[model samples]
Target: MAGARVTTGSRLGVRIREVPVPADLDAPDAWLLRGQVDTVNEVEIALRGNRDMCRNPHETLGSMREQRYTTKIRLVAVDEDRPGDAADPARVLGHAALHLPRQDNTHTGEVDLGVRPAARRRGIGSALHDAALEVARVHGRTMLTTTTQQTSEPTDGPLALAPSTGSGRLHRDDPGVRFALTRGWSLEQVSRYSVLDVPLPADVLAAHRAAAQAVAGPDVRVVLWESRCPDEWVDQFALLQTRMSTDVPHGGIARHADVWDAARVRTIEQQFLDQGLGYLVAAAEHVPTRTLVAFTALAATPVTDEFVFQNDTLVMREHRGRRLGMLVKTANLQRLAAERPAVQRVGTWNAEENAHMLAINVALGFRPAGGTGEWQRDL
Candidate 1:
């Protein structure tokens, strides 16, 4: 059970305490706990002006509760009779996940907050975030993390169009980045967003398809995903994710690799479905003498009628060449266009020097979206 203690701050009288483990999670607490993304959306909106830029981030069911259970998450209740009754009971004023030992620490707990907009200027966020810090401190974690985008970048800024949950303006950075600054979190990393516009010429697409098909031979297969997921694909998807952990240029992630599990992958999928994900493909090619050689995917998100996000695309190491990457990209585009015909552009990112990925992206029409350093602090 949560060990309640008296604490005073902001306009609300509140009992800040540790949230109990799974056993004591009541229905309301459980429900509220499950609403992390909602809290996140509100928190993000309150900080950044745009509210429709973070949709479809994960693809798992009941992902929020599962994450809280897994991450050492906490919930702080504002006592109605206490000093901050002006704050809404339902608002998750602060939230911080443990910065358990991992590959990186520049951004960890204190990175994201979920406070209600109306509760701003009150000490709720600080208290909640500070409470998050307590969770990290007890665990021996040193870094408190957070970030907000730069508002003045450009209409064609690096980020691909992402959907935020509430009705808000677009292209505005949240003030939460300020929260990180005040709390001592510094700019640790920045990645550019790149895109491919002006569709590939019909001749070019046709030639690329033919080349990929010829390279793979008759047994090699590339399958396009429809709206609903199929049963046979789940395990395959998980296997592909294992490869992703090491492949991405995430040199500063704070969570340890051992912490990853099938549940995490499932949650990402659940979050994606909740946010309206679009287009996917799984590729496998039968090499000569019956060897199966390649696999990859091209996934994207629609920003507006004219823009789509080519989020993260990956090709298995052993199957790097042989056109499997191209096959998946072509397939994703074909499927995306068919399902959402009006999308006219696509964007993506890759480490500045990753030649292979850059080659593939360039071939398909992606251009540089700037680059940000992936700096981190040893917390």
Candidate 2:
């Protein structure tokens, strides 16, 4: 639904337009859309210099289309084609996307913006952001959220194994940080990124698994599922999903609680399928009640075999005494090894203050990889 009208910078011939994906999205448009990620990745590489990164626009767009969360995407393009431009004439210079979640976090909208390295400081980012903020306002969102990364700081201890920013590399300051602060965004939360190298030493994996197994005891059972939850466990699984909003530590950030039902759970599961990404889930069950007491998930995209994303590990409070968290996590690690053997490592994020979860991750050999600042601004 791209119209002839432009949103900004007519004098510079930079046009900002919506890239709508109708139900019947065609190959040509999809290819064009995916190129934007490539441009963004190029910029990321220049900034990050290859610290394990992967982005699949196919999954991003498809997931957005299927999820209950609505999204508005705006792309800035130059009318004149440039040499080596993947998208000619309407060469995508940058883009911004606003995500509005339906279940909860209704008062908040997440915003992500990226500008090509060569296109920075040309007002494309600001223009796209302006348009995105307008869209958020139209949807009645009161707060805008975004994340920015700083180069990993030097550290000793287990985190020392993580990659460094190279000598003389600036650590604290970044253009994104300045951009957000200048626009009135306030830092809300800091989450540390970590990665676990795959194929942990036989002794290490065995020791951790044995220790967790001993704590889990005979009354607890582990369950494994791919992509979809079974009908019988759907309700319990949904409850656990809802609990994550309150259970997980969010630091000082104002996180909205979520309400999840079986149908909504299935909708999210289906959205992963629509994105063509692989999903692996592991849950622990209480033997007597046959109830799912804890769960964790890992997602892998076809774009890269080098890394997989570890997401959402949650254990119910009543089930906390046992090592259910460790059990389910180790169980999923075993699954990830068998199913996605090509994956070389797994990356995860944890709030800086979540000592319990961080301890579990450290026990599993996940070392600090980087850090990101979660910023928020009142609309």
Candidate 3:
């Protein structure tokens, strides 16, 4: 592998191949690896080309898994000829990627590319893109999509993101965005980040609690679940996963079967528990029927800023105006506040046009911090 990568940065003997599981050594001077791994060695290096933690290598990796496809492409560009002796041996020169999945109706998730300052606009970015598009077409899928931070700074510079840990900041002029635009990808969906500058104020929280209490009634019970909850709920969690698409505005829709499964639910539940966080779910119990309507859930993991990650707040068509969204969010927020009181601020991203969820967030006092436009190219 070292012999293959020995080259000068001015010219790369680039090679792109779809070698699965065990990667191939003779594949290329420049390379990409795909699939789930217990380790990422350093994807963060490619994501944090900005000052703010706008690019999430962790979340991006999760997206690939959540979509039940390996939308993950790991690129390695090194001076193959110079590998044996340099101040920093095997110094990666360029990194760009996209995840491709057949189950996603041939959908692909393109990511921002990061390049070392010594190499830019020299066709490396174009080559990465060409590789992504080829995958989309070969898989019999029609669309390829990705997101980038909307910024006014220069986007073709020498910034980099640390790998794995979702903490490094990306520069506004990071080369990833520049490569995305230059390659002809256009806006698809816009994802915005909301930051709670202050806490979810006292009085407003009181009023929200009252609202949930006022309407939750005796039949609908809101509950918080930690690892201690009965494992039998995995079936219910699996069902809830199918309802996730009720409100999100992402471009390519994931198949219900791909997102819902008892085993997958158990894995996610365990992951939350292992991380010392749980989720809030609202269920309506009808004593007469002996069944529960699993309506919504809000889950979060404690990161540097205490992310109040919210997902899947679904209401049956018959229950829409009943404020179930507010009920679920309020329950989760109160639970987190009471339990993990150290958690100060909450943040979430909503489609610019998802008024229902937006209304709920605004009512809960989540304010907009930034927005990202989802771009797609039809193959």
Candidate 4:
């Protein structure tokens, strides 16, 4: 039912259509893609005060092409009532993305929905959610996952709703929270969203790196690269990604280990490059075996010089105590400062229950900004 149009009986005459993936940036309908990205960023900024989580339109399109996951994009628009009402005949109000993993976690699908701030209370979000649910059911997905962001933790009162993890709470009165609760979704876990001001003092970073190196000993060394992974370490890097899927604290979220290999790794790398993103990776090598025992990645888009994102940072379970996490993170941050000095901030998210990683982030001077609630529903 891709591209099928459905009109709703609202004052604005809202229409929801499944968007087809464009061939390139110059495609005729590419404006819809840009509109989707704009809507999401607008909603995020309205909720959290910063558009740190905004995705480049090129990246979103490239991700849509990945074989490992099937992503369906849907856009909600309002029909113009007058001939000269607006520049665009259909003004985009919001969008929804339903992601179905092809390999592991086949029974689970992820639904991400957002509505423009000025367009809320118009039943647009509920319409998009209902469409996503129908699509998930059609795909035979038994479980669905989504998230809601809040700028601050709600006080412990009647309006607060705590997750089963019991670590963080979200305000029950929040529109997103209320939307999910009334639909049978449960708050599974809360994740702390943090930001670190970049270009930290050179001496401070040097001291942290030196100390971590001492603890890691001579047996472990760090290797840094940009854009692509060298052939020698590609296999090991893939293994770490596979481990990351299961090793991270999920906290009651129904998910399974994601399988990754060298080919999948290479595909994503190429996608990132095509999306105009600059990514740097630092991996800790076990000198004896010459395997990547830990790794961390930092990425930024040239569209914005002031911000970068902290991607996955995973240290193998067996290599946890040697401060390798700190070692790789510091190495990457130092490199980021040297290569992309324009970046003034780095943003990241971690499960609130993951104390070890949280402690590491805290030591790096990252401060809490906001948090997200992982919501799940079993159909």
Task: Work out the TM-score per prediction.
Answer: 0.60, 0.87, 0.66, 0.94
Q: Output the better candidate (1/3) by TM-score.
A: 3
Q: Give the TM-score (vs. native) of candidate 1.
A: 0.60
lDDT of model 4 at position 153: 80
Candidate 3 lDDT by residue in tens digits, 245-264: 44345543232234556776
The C-alpha RMSD of each candidate to the native structure, in angstroms, is 8.0, 5.1, 8.2, 2.1
Off by over 4 Å in 1: 1-39, 43-61, 67-69, 72-111, 114-125, 137-148, 151-188, 194-220, 226-237, 252-279, 289-311, 321-323, 340-349, 352-379
Best by TM-score: 4
10 residues in a row with least lDDT, candidate 4: 81-90
Backbone clash pairs for candidate 4 read none
Model 2: worst 10 consecutive residues (lDDT sum): 161-170
Model 4 stretches astray by more than 4 angstroms: 2-10, 78-90
The model with the greatest lDDT is 4
**Candidate 1: residue 377 lDDT (0-100):** 33
**Considering lDDT, which of the candidate structures 2 and 3 is the better prediction for this target?**
2
lDDT for every model?
0.51, 0.74, 0.51, 0.84
Q: Over the full model, what C-alpha lDDT does candidate 2 score relative to the true structure?
A: 0.74
> What is the per-residue lDDT of model 1 for residues 341-360, given as tens digits with 9 covering 90 to 100?
66666766555345666777
**Better by lDDT, candidate 4 or 1:** 4
Q: For candidate 4, lDDT tens digit of each residue in 104-193?
A: 888998888898888777777877888788888888899999999888788789998889999888889988899999999999999988
